[model samples]
Target chain A: MPELLILVPFTGALLCFLFPGHIRDVIGLLCAVLTFVASIILTGNIYQNGPIRLNLGGWKEPLGIGMCVDGLSVLFIFLTGIVGLLVSLYSVSFFSKANNQSLAKHFWPLWLFLWGSLNSIFFVSDIFNAYVVMELISISAAALAALSGTNASLIAALRYFLLAMAGSMAFLLGVGFLYAQTGTLDMYLLGAVTDGGPLMAMALGLMTVGLIMKTALFPFHFWLPPAHGEAPAPVSAVLSALVIKGSFYLLLRIWCTVFQDTTASPQTATLLGLLGLTGVIWGSYQAIIQNRLKLIIAYSSVGQVGYLFLLFPLVFITLDPAWKIEAWTACVFQTISHGLAKAALFLAAGNLIHATGTENLKSMRNIADRLPMTTFTLALAGVSLMGLPPSGGFVAKWMLLQSILASGQWWLAAAPILGGLLTAAYIFRILSQAFVSDDQISCCGHVSFVMEKSALLLAIFSILIGFRSKEVIFLLSEQVYFVIQGGIIP
Target chain B: MTTLLIYAFTSIILFSIGLFGLVSHPNLIRKIVSLNIMGGGAFLFLISLAYHGRSPDIDPVPQAMVLTGIVVTISATAFALCLTRRIREKTGQCLLEHCPDKPET
Candidate 1:
């Protein structure tokens, strides 16, 4: 049954690539829905029997390839399914408006293929295969970013493309070092074999740098704002929301599992936490200074990513021995909430930009009455972004704060809170402008309801996450590590 | 240990040179070219470290990964070039350092 969850997207991608142009969006939406349903079923299976494991091509563990579906993979899987669906819905209206028939045909296949790549990355038992999936995702993402057909977007995509390649190559080298030392690429096998040695340490450094580059953490984030800001809105939504998380999810999983022993020095995790802390300040500063709305959201993503990494160091050993579950639960929850909220925000921004024919802040200040639904959805998404009361972002922030404080790392809490305020500041910058109702409002065509509804629905889900903390926490704690390693680690 | 350190040094030097080229060059195509050189250095470093100090003896897994990374990087570069050429066609200039400020929409 868990196998079905991964297979659905793969088959869907191929079908999408083969479909007739006119029906591709419909087929893609159906595929995303099916993938979501399958994931729900898979979650039920996990509820019954912890983590579900399957070997693809009949390969055994520590030998051939395998799929390990744990709480984290399921979380990301569910996110990809839902986000993939909404982006498709948004794109139908989006590309249709510009009469971009060519892009419409290509969008589904690339998105579905990306969905498959992302899902598989979370589940792959071997580090080597994870590298392959990373490359696949990068190609598709670069292609998607170029869909704008704008000169700025095209150059931005190219720059992003080069950086992603460089990062991937660095990761490949790190995998090499690991394989040399441990003689195994399987995460489970590596867990048993490797200790905090020099080669392994060096490998971890390489991998971390590579992953940070992809995550656009801070110093390495020059490629992000351009790639994200210049791309079409729906593409930007997925790039920020779903795709970027793939590398981080793997990094986190590796730290908790394969690189678990490497954290013994404490400096390693502390250094990472410091980087995240730095990112929060730097990214927020940039976001605040941006005049364009989408650029603001893109820079803000750099800030949010910091919290995820910092939370790692804050919770390394402080949680109640059982508190690993709570900390990771909060971590995963924070990630998904951000994804949902960011997607909605971008979609709303897209529709508004479309209606007003510009994303300039001075222009959108009078955009409120003309596009009320888009305005409301942006505010709703902002609630999640700001970590305000009753939104999932609020719950995620609360849980992370509790974990950090519990760990006695009081410094960590400052970032998320400050980050939230900045998030509120920038998001509200757009929100206030959205309320502009002056006669000077020069706008474009009205957006179709199709684009607005799914976006609102996503924003609502982000808020609804606040109420489901119990269930979501339970799901995140369900043994993702053991699923990959087959409970073989000592 | 000495051999590993030497390989790492060479990789870092090459990487630094490529980085310098990438940052210093204004041409979009040259940046891509420099970036790939950096990638080559990094990949070689990985292969060198993963080599078990013997011919046909190094682990095949990382080798396979490096191969896949090569293909993927090439594919991404191709797409990026297509985008770059298109951008040149439209705006007549690629952003080298400071982008020419177009008044905000």
Candidate 2:
């Protein structure tokens, strides 16, 4: 199944590359749907059984490559599926309107290749393989960012490409150090051999820093807004919604498993949590001030990324199982909900920009009347962004609050609440402009139902996720081994 | 010092220089070159890790990984160079600076 997940999109990408025409989009959509179906089946199989483990070439754990699909991988795989399907649907409409058929040809191959790379990242258990997956994702993503051929996007892609390369090199170097010490690249094996030492600490530090740069955490988040904001809308949605999560997932995998015993000290975890706290405050403030709609959403990603980091401290500070489960649940929930809502927001924003032919929030006055569904999608996605009740964001926030209060870590608990308010403020900026009546609203193109429906469905899912907390929590916790606990240290 | 120590220190120095070049240089091409240098340092480090007391008894994993890393780095560098070229052709500037004259959309 894991092999199928990687093969389907990759093969589709090759087909698209060979046949770059109207047929490419159809092929791309078919591949994405097939991948999603395979992922769902994989998840169901994991549920019935424990975890699925595959040893490539029949080589055992420490000797050759192995892949594991635990609860975490299953959740992320599902996320890639949901977001991949919607983005593919949205892209078909998006690129058709673009009129540059040649660009569409380039887009299908790169996008599907990116989708394949993301699934590979989630499925691979070996750290070095993960590095390769990261590189593939970065290259494809950089190409996609430059697909629009605009000067702004081109520059952004250039900068993004450099940072991603540098970051991955640092990651590779860390992999070197770990291999030197443990003589293995499998994360689970590294857990057994690793001890608290300077080399391990240095390796952890280097890898964490590298992943942070790639993940765009706190001070390193400078490259994200430009890259995500300037890309074509569906591409922006993919980059913002799914690409960064790849590195974030890598960080989570490394910290919890490979570095479980030797790393994640109280001070280091708190330091990360502090950065997450700062990112929430800083990114939300930046989002509120942006005039362009996509920039605002991009900056909000920088903020929401902070929420994921908060889990590190909350999980590290307590030894209680309940606390760990709650923090883990909240963090994963936040990631999924954020991916759905942000993708919806970008697609809807893109449709609005298409209709009005301008990206400025001020110029977007009275667009709600013309594009009701798009506006409604924006509002629905905003509800999740603001952590409103009866939405996935609210559930994640509520769980996070419960965990923080349980641990009595009151200082950092305020970040999420304050971030929510800040999120509300920026979302209101767009929604308010939507209400005003403007006589000279210039619409440049027709908004397709395909585009609007895709955005709306993702937004609705983001909201509906709030109601599925029990099932999601069950799926995440049951029948799946937590790698940190299952590893040799414990 | 042992040969391993010497190689390790050389790789570290190379990495430091590459990181410094990356941070200090404003030109995109220079930055890309710096990235390649940093990647070279990592690859060197990985290869050195393969040296376990003798020539024939080296670790093959890091070698395989280094080989993969080199290919990945080349593709990224190639892509970055192409993007830099495109940016130069479009805007006539290699440095990524925000010109205050043009408004951001």
Candidate 3:
């Protein structure tokens, strides 16, 4: 089933390339549905029993490459499925509305390749496999970013590609060091062999810096806004929603599981938390000042990504056992909430841009009456982004605050609230443009109902997830406890 | 252990040079080349780990990893070069627009 998770999209990508023009979208949709169903089944099976670890080609551990899916991997895989399905559906209508059939044809293969690469990353248990998949993800993403073929977009893609390569190289160096020290590539084995030596510390530093660069956290996020803003909307949605999370998931897995014994110093965790705090404040300020709607959301992603790092310091320092679960759940839930909300925001922003034939927020004035559905989608997604009541983002914030307070870190709690206020400022900025009664403001083009519906559905799910917090927390706890039980390296 | 430390130091120096070039260079080709150099240093580090006490006693895993790394590096460099060419053709400048003389104007 895990192999099928990778094979389905890869085969579909090949079929997409080989098949005729008319059937490419069909193949893409079929692959999305197949992968989504397979991921659900994989998650369910894992939940019912336990994590699955498979040695490829019948080769045993330390010799053969392996794939493993714990509760964490399942959570990410399920996210990829949901976001992939919505993006695939949105693409079908998005291209048709633009009447760019040729570009649409080129999009399917690259998109599938990226989707498969992401699945491979989440499932791989070997450090070397992680590096390879990271490269695969970077290459496919760079190509996808360049699909628009505009000067700005291409330049952005080039910069993104180069930085990503540098990041991956650093990561591979870390892998090399780990292999040298432990003589094993499997993460489970490495955990037992690794010690808090100079080599391990160096490897951790190199890998963390590399993964954070790829994740586009704060200072290294210079390339993200342009790449995201200039790309076709569906591509931007996937890049912002999933690709960035790939490296982040790696960092989380390594730090939380493999290097749990070699936890970074409290100072390092504090530094990371400070950087994240900077990202929230800085990214939100930039987002508020952006004229282009997509650029605003792109910058908003930089801010939202900050929330993910807040867990580092909390998880690293908290001695209370209960706070550990709270921090973990908050981190994972925050990831899911932001993923759905941001995807919805990008897709809806795409619709608005499509309808108005402009990305400038000013021209979007009075578009609420013109395209009410898209407007509603944007508002729904915005509510989640701002962490308002009865939304997934709100629940995440609540859990984060609870943990922060439990840890007696009252000062740290102010960051999220302030971030939320700034988020509201920017969201309302866009919403006000939509609500204004400007007679000259008019939507120039038709946005397909399918496109609007896809964004709306994702936004609804973003809110709906708030109600399912118990189940989400339960799934996260299952794996958290498993790690505590010393189940790996057996 | 001394030899390993020397090799590690050499890789670090190589990596730092590449990192310096990547940060300091304005030209896209230079940046790409810097990235390749950085990758070379990392691959060197990986391959060096395969070396054991004797010449024949080499680990197969790091060698295999280096081979895969080389393939990935080639493709990435190729893609970056293609984008460089496109940027050159589209704007007639390989330098990024971070300077005072912005390209858009």
Candidate 4:
């Protein structure tokens, strides 16, 4: 099943390259649906039986590549599946328009390749494999970002590509250092063998910095706004929603497992948390000031991402095991909720841009009357971003706040509270334009019903997940136990 | 042992130089070359690690990794070059800092 998760998208990507026009669209959609189904079955299998590990080509670990799916990875796979399918649906209509026909030719292949790489990142059990898969993701995602062919997008893609390449090099050097010290490429083996030595510390520092750069944590986020804001809508949705999460998931996994005991000092974790807090405030402030709708959403991603880094500090500083689990689950919740909300917001912004033929937020005055479905989608997604009640973002922030309070990190509590307010500020900034009555409502194009509904469904799912947090929490706790027991080394 | 130390120091210096060039230069082509230099430093470090032991045979793993790394780096550099060419053609700009910040329509 894990192999199926990778194989389907890759094969579909190859088929997409072979076919042309309508046939390629059908193949891309079919591949997406197949990948989603495989992910569902894979998740269920893990739920019923436990985590599954596959030795590629019947080769044993420490020799050949290994793919493993624990509770954490399965959750990510499921996310990619859900977002990939809807985005695929959205893209089918998105690229069918007259102007986007040239883009459709490249979008299918690159997107499927990206999906395959994302799945592989979640499944790989070795650091070197993670590096390789990350490179694959960076190249494909950069290509997708440049699909719009605008000067801004082209420049953004170049900037993004260069930074990501540098980050990957740092990551590779870290991998080299780890392999030098431990002589093992497998993550579990490295965890078992490593001690709190200078080599381990160096490797940890290098890898963390590399991953942070790739994740676009506050200080390194210069390329994100332009790249994400300038991409075509579906591509923007995917890049904002899923691509960044890929590196983040790897960072979480490596920090918790291989570096958990060796060199993951409390000070370093706290430093990460501090950066995250600043990102929340800084990114939200930037979002509030952006004139363009997509740029606003892009900056909001930087803010929301700050919440994920809070997990490191909360988990590291707390002594109680229960609080640690809460922090872990909270971070994952934040990731998923933010991903869905951000994706929905971008797609909605896309629709608004499409309708008005403008990216300016002020021109969207009276959008409430022009495009009710999309406006509602934006509002619902806004509720999630604001961490309001009965939304996934609310659940994540609530759990995060509880864990922060329980751990006596009173200072850390400011981020979610203050960040939420700032978030609401920007969210309302966009939403407020809906109510303003302007005579010159210049809606130039028609948005297909399918495009609006897909975005709406994604927004609805972001809220719906809030009501069903128990299962996700349960799955995460199970994985946490597996990590604690050191049961995965086999 | 001395050889290993020399190689390691050389790799680090190369990496730092590339990083400096990457940060100081705004020209797209120079940035691309700096990225490759950085990659070269990393690959060299990996190669040096493969020879850290006093055995008759060198470690094959890092060697394999370096080869794969080189392949990935080549493809990435090629892509960067393509984007650079397009940017130059479309807007007649070669420096990243010179690109305009207007929102796409």
Candidate 5:
């Protein structure tokens, strides 16, 4: 099933490349749906049975490539499946327009390739494979960012590619250091054998820095806003929603499993939390000031990413197992909710751009009068982003606050609360434009029903998941045991 | 062991040089070349690790990984070069800073 998860999208990419015109669209959508189904089934299988591991070509681990699907990986896979499908749906109409025909030709293949690589990243069991898959993701994502073929986008893609390449090299070098220390490449094997020596510390530092760079955490996020903001809407949606999460997932996995015992000091985790806190404040502040709609959403991603890192400090500082799980689930919830809401926001921004023929937020004044559905979608997504009641973002932040307070780390709570206020400031800033009565609103293009509704579906899902948080919490705790207990799978 | 340490030190020096070049240079082609140099440094480190043990037969895993790494590096370099060409053709500029800001959509 894991193999199928990776194979289907790759096969679809190949087929999409072979076909042309409308045929590629059909193939792309079909493959997306298939991948989604496979992921659902895979998640169900893991839920029923324990976590499953697959050895490729009938070979054993340490010699053959291994793929593992646990609660954590399945959660991410489910996210990619959900967001990838909706974005693919949006792209169908997005590219069908007269002006986007050239971009459509390259979009399906690159997108499917990216989806395949994201799945592989989540499923990978070794550091070397993670490096390879990450490189694939960087290449495909950079290509997609440049699909608009504009000068700014090309420059953004180049910057993104160069930085990602440097990050990947650093990661590979870390893998070499780990192999030299443990004589094994498998994550679980290395974890069991590692003794928290100087070599292990060096490997951890190198790997963490590399993944942090790729994830675009604060202080290293220079490449993200342009690459995400300047890309076409659907492209921005996927890049913002999924690509950075790919690296974050790897970072979380390695810290939880491979480095769980080695050098996971409270000081190091607190250092991460500090950076994340800065990211939250800085990114939100930047978002509040951005004139372009997409750039606002892109910068917010930098802030939302900050929230994910708070989990490290909260979990690592508290010896209480319950709070550890609370912190863990909070981070995962934040990731999912942010993914959905941010994607919805970008897609709705795309619709606005399509309708008004501009990316500037000022041009959207009084847009609520003309495009009520899109305005509502943006507001609904904004509700989640603001961490309002009965939304996924609220649940995440609430739990995060609970864990922070429970751990007696009251100071750490400032980031979420302040970040939330800043988020509301920006979200309302956009929403207020809807109410302003501008007589000269220039809507030059049409937004297709499918495009608007797809964005709406994601926004609605972001809220709906808040109500059904039990299962996700259950799934996450099951894996938290495996992670915290230091049980190396044999 | 001494030989391994020497090779590892050389690889680190190469990596530092590449990183320096990458940060210091403004030319896109030069940046790409610097990235390849960084990859070379990493691959060299991995290759030297394959010879870490005194046994007659070397560990083949790092060698295999190096081979795969080379393939990935070539493709990325090729893609970067292609983008550079496209940027040159479209904007008549090779440096990232010189390219005009994208007009607001």
Candidate 6:
């Protein structure tokens, strides 16, 4: 089953490429449905029994690549299943309306292939395997981003591809550093072998720099705005919404599981957390001022990611370290909520742009009546983005605040409060545009129910996920309490 | 000891140079090339860090990592190349490409 998760989409991708244009959508849909069903079964099987550890070619952990279906990996696989399905379906109508069937034919297979790569990244237990899967995700994503077929889009994709290479290389070097000391690339094996020394330091530096670059963390984030802004709206939606999360997911996984012992210094975590806080402020500030709606959302994504890192300092505030679970949970919840909300916002924005034939903020200012459904989608998503009542973003932010308050980091309290306010300001800037009723607004076309409805569903999930906090927490807790110190390594 | 450190220092300098090129160069392909150089430098630095008592005794992990890095870099460059070619084919102008003039004159 572990191997099949890697197998299914890869085979599907090849078949899609080799086969003719006929039935491509059907093939893509089947691949997503089957992958989702397989994931659900795997989840039930794991919950009923234990982790399924698979070694490739019958090789052992330290010798060959391995895959593990722990609680975290399973949850992410499920997200891939869900998000992949919606994006695939949305792509069907999205391209159809544009009358670009040939483009649609090519898109379905590549997108499904990307879906497969993302799911496998979550399950890989070996560092080298993780590297390979990250590469797969990055390549597929670069292709998808470049599909817009514009000069600027291609150049932007080109720029992003180079920067992404630099980041990936740094990550690989970090793996090399670890191998130098531990002589193994299996994450589980490295756990028991590592100590907070020179090799570990080098490895940590390499890994964090690579993942942060992938995440588009502040200073290294030059590639994001152009790549996203230049891509087709749906492609931009997924790139901003889902693909970037893969690296951050790995960052969180490694920070909690592998680097926990070494990175336990609260002061260091606090400094990292501060870096995140700055991303939030800087991202939001730029987001509010952007004239282009899509660019604004892209920059806002940078700011929102910063809030997740704030949980690090509080992860071990008690010095007991048992509370790392809360820190990890807060961060993950923020990630999931923002991902769902932002995807919906971008999709809705795409719909609006498609209908109006422009993404200018000034034009959107008087075009609400023309795009009723898209407006509703953006508003609902904005509710979650602003971290207000009855929404998952609210609960996620509340959880982080509770932990910071509990840890007596009263100063850290300003981050979520001010960040949320900044978020609201930008969200409202877009939202207020929805209510403008000027007769001077000349829009282009009409958006359909399927496109608008899919956006709404993801947006609503962003709000409702907060209600499942306890269950989600329980689901993620089975493997280890995020920061495992005194346990067997592999 | 000094040989490995020197290699590592050279890699660091190369990476910094690539970073400078990335920010300074407006050409798309040049930017892509610089990025690969930076990646190469990082790989070199890692291999240097893993350099030990002898070449034969050196860490296999860094070597494995460098190999994977090379593959990923190639794949990314391939996709970006595809996109760049498509852009050049469509617009017929690459040097003066800018997005600000989109949607209108």
lDDT (CA) for every model shown?
Answer: 0.78, 0.86, 0.86, 0.90, 0.90, 0.75
- Pairs in clash, predicted candidate 1: A365-A436, A366-A436
Measured by DockQ, the strongest candidate is 4
Q: Which stretches of candidate 5 lie over 4 Å from their true place?
A: A485-490
Q: Compared with the true structure, what per-residue lDDT tens digits does model 2 show for residues A291-346?
A: 99999999999999999999888887766767777887899899999999999999
Question: Each candidate: fraction of true contacts kept?
Answer: 0.55, 0.75, 0.70, 0.79, 0.74, 0.62
Question: What is candidate 3's lDDT per residue for A361-478, written digit by digit as tens?
Answer: 9899878888899889899999999999899999999999899899876767866888999999999999999998887665568788899899999999999989988877767887
**Which residue pairs in model 5 clash with each other?**
A358-B105, A359-B105
Q: What is the DockQ of each candidate?
A: 0.44, 0.61, 0.56, 0.69, 0.66, 0.46
Off by over 4 Å in 6: A47-50, A263-267, A316-323, A365-371, A442-444, A481-490, B1-26, B42-68, B82-100, B103-105
**Residue A326 lDDT (model 6):** 63
Write candidate 5's Cα lDDT for A1-490 as tens digits.
9999899999999999999899999999999999999998988888777688889998898889998888889889998999999999999999999989889989999999999999999999988999999999999999999999888999899999999999999999889888888888988887677478877888888899999998999999999999999899999999999999999999988888788855777888999999999999999999999988999999999999999999888877787888888888999999999999999999999999999888888898878888899999999999999899999999999999999999998878988999999999999989898778777775647799999999999999999889978988877887532466422232
lDDT of 4 by residue, B1-105 (tens): 889788888988898899999999989899999988898889899999887775668988899999999999999999999999989988887877656766344
Q: Which portions of model 4 show Cα errors greater than 4 Å?
A: A480-490, B101-105
lDDT of 1 by residue, A239-338 (tens): 9999889989988867766776443346777888888888988898889989998899899888888878875675554535545555667777889999
lDDT at A262, model 6: 66
Residue A334 lDDT in candidate 5: 95
| TM-score for each model | 0.91, 0.96, 0.96, 0.98, 0.98, 0.90
- Error in Å for residue A347 of model 6: 1.3
What TM-score does each model's chain B reach against the true chain B? 0.77, 0.87, 0.86, 0.91, 0.92, 0.84
Per-residue lDDT of candidate 4, residues A1-490 (tens digit): 8999999999999999999889999999999999999999988887767777789999998889998788889989988988999999999999999989999999999999999999999998999989999999999999999998988899899999999998998999899888878888988777777577888899999999999999999999989999999999999999999999999999987897687755888899999999999999999999999999999999999988899999888987788888888888999999998888888999999999988888888899989888999999999999998999999999999999999999998999999999999999999999899778798776557999999999999999999989989988877887532353322232
Q: Candidate 2: lDDT over CA atoms?
A: 0.86
Q: Is the docking of candidate 2 incorrect, acceptable, medium or high quality?
A: medium
Per-residue alpha-carbon lDDT of model 3 for B59-92, expressed as tens digits? 7888999999999899889988988898888888
Model 6: pairs clashing at backbone N, Cα or C within 3 Å = none
